[model samples]
Target: MPSSAMPASRTDLDQQPPAAITAAGLRKSYGDKTVLDGIDLHIPAGSVFALLGPNGAGKTTAVKILSTLVSADGGTARVAGHDLAADPQSVRAAIGVTGQFSAVDGLITGEENMLLMADLHHLPRREGRRVAAELLERFDLADAATKPASTYSGGMKRRLDIAMTLVGTPSIIFLDEPTTGLDPRSRQNMWQIVRELVAGGTTVFLTTQYLEEADELADRVAVLNDGRIAAHGTAEELKRLVPGGHVRLRFTDPTAYRSAASALRDVTRHDEALALQLPSDGSQRDLRAVLDRLDAAGVEADELTVHTPDLDDVFFALTGGTTVPHQAEEASR
Candidate 1:
């Protein structure tokens, strides 16, 4: 690797423009087994795109190919305005990757590690020190700047690793399960960092086993299954894939509950609680039809709450209740 340490000169970076990432017919294999089978992906510039799946679903393989760490057996991809294979150097220069594990060197002080990255980028000594100091402050690691990475907590080490990645100031980033082993608080901190990066015009390509993380951070999400993309959409759009979304109608009086239940044929009755669960897709049209029927029957529900299927529901329905191993791995670690 050439010195990653270099001051991004105005002329050097200013000339290059940002571009969306696109993959077509991407495929990869390991000897006898196929890992990625003709996957297609499109990640818009300045957006957070999340790739989700089970442990052996080829999420890492996709990331590796896009980040230039591993060769794809088939397919074509473009990253940061450069062809993934033809101009790999340009792609590498334009993107940063933070894998599941912390890349921080335990023996080096936090500040030194950052400065080292700056040097690797080929920044002038004064410029490298300046960038290092700025990153320490940005990541809230300034207080522990002089402390060796081994002395930092898991969260601090993770933050430092990301800060180092940002040293080169790449416009696009690949974060592979970045918060996999973090505590709730640390995970939230990382989320904030990701949001800030996107807000500042950096595009993020994230892969995680945490469905909640994808729901919370991604502008769009793609679920990979069996070496292929099973589903891709916004969180709400994906949730719509699973059934069982419904509206619960709570009546103030027994008379109203009875009337409402009779009016809606599929209404699930709960006489004791004075509530009826309707099998609704939770669409506005469905809710309107239900309300019109209630009006005709002269029945009114005191409380109406709509429940939509979440990512967990979609995951279970699509994967046959196979709990994603990544989520358990994250929780245990």
Candidate 2:
């Protein structure tokens, strides 16, 4: 976390391409079933990019193809400056992956798992020991380092899983539904770790079923539907794409409510609740203007609330209810 410890080369991590990851016209199929139909992705280094979709939406398929665990039937992909097909070894060397399930070997101690990952990375014995120790400490697994992974709590196991993924010092990582099944507190812990990784110049490719997770963590997000990108943008940008955004104003008395509703002719009334809803783009200027109008009319709302369409609205609007089937599949996974 030391500012001076930052790498000098990290400054260029943002502007370069093939980027940390790049996929163009990527296609995949199993037998006659098309898993990925000409998908495209571009994730800059040192940024968190969330790939969101319900089950069978090709989220895992895309992750596998990019991670070199499965070959793409068509198209091109580059990971950390290496072409996935032609130089898979190089790609393997440059990135790490934590899949949807816990890959931690239950029989082994937490420290052993970290050391195992170091060995896979082909680090020297002395260096591997150093890295394992450092990672165990960093992930707060030091106390349980000597305990079998099976003895770790759900959250502890998850921390160890991610810690193992970092043993190789990968600059780019793929986290497939990394927080799946974790409790809220554990999920938040994982989010903090992800932020720390990106802050240290590690690009994160995250796939998750939780819409709010993506909204909270991703610098940019792409919602995949039926193996194709339905939409992609920053969280706020995606939110803005959905309509029905409004501002609600509540008055203490019926008189005040009537005055405000009459002053705003186009407002929708909720007479029983003593509230009125005015259509708004959900912008600060619009809010100020609305309040100014009420003030000039000698009216004031006792309480105010802003409502904007969230990702749920965006998902339903774009893909109908197909995400339900997809989520069912993820839960199974």
Put down candidate 1 lDDT per residue, 164-281, tens digits, no spaces. Answer: 9999999999999999889999999999999999999999999998989999999888878788777787887777667778889998798888889999978788889999998776
Name model 2 segments beyond 4 Å from true: 1-18, 251-259, 263-265, 272-274, 283-304, 321-333
Cα lDDT tens digits for candidate 2, 159-224? 999999999899999999999889999999999999999989899999998988898899888888
Per-model TM-score, in order, reads 0.88, 0.83
lDDT scores for all predictions? 0.87, 0.86
Q: Judge candidate 1 at residue 259 and give its lDDT.
A: 85
Best by TM-score: 1
Model 2: ten consecutive residues of lowest lDDT: 324-333
- Top candidate on lDDT is 1
Candidate 1 Cα errors over 4 Å, as ranges: 1-19, 321-333
**Clashing residue pair totals per candidate (backbone < 3 A):** 12, 1
Q: In terms of TM-score, how similar is model 1 to the real structure? A: 0.88
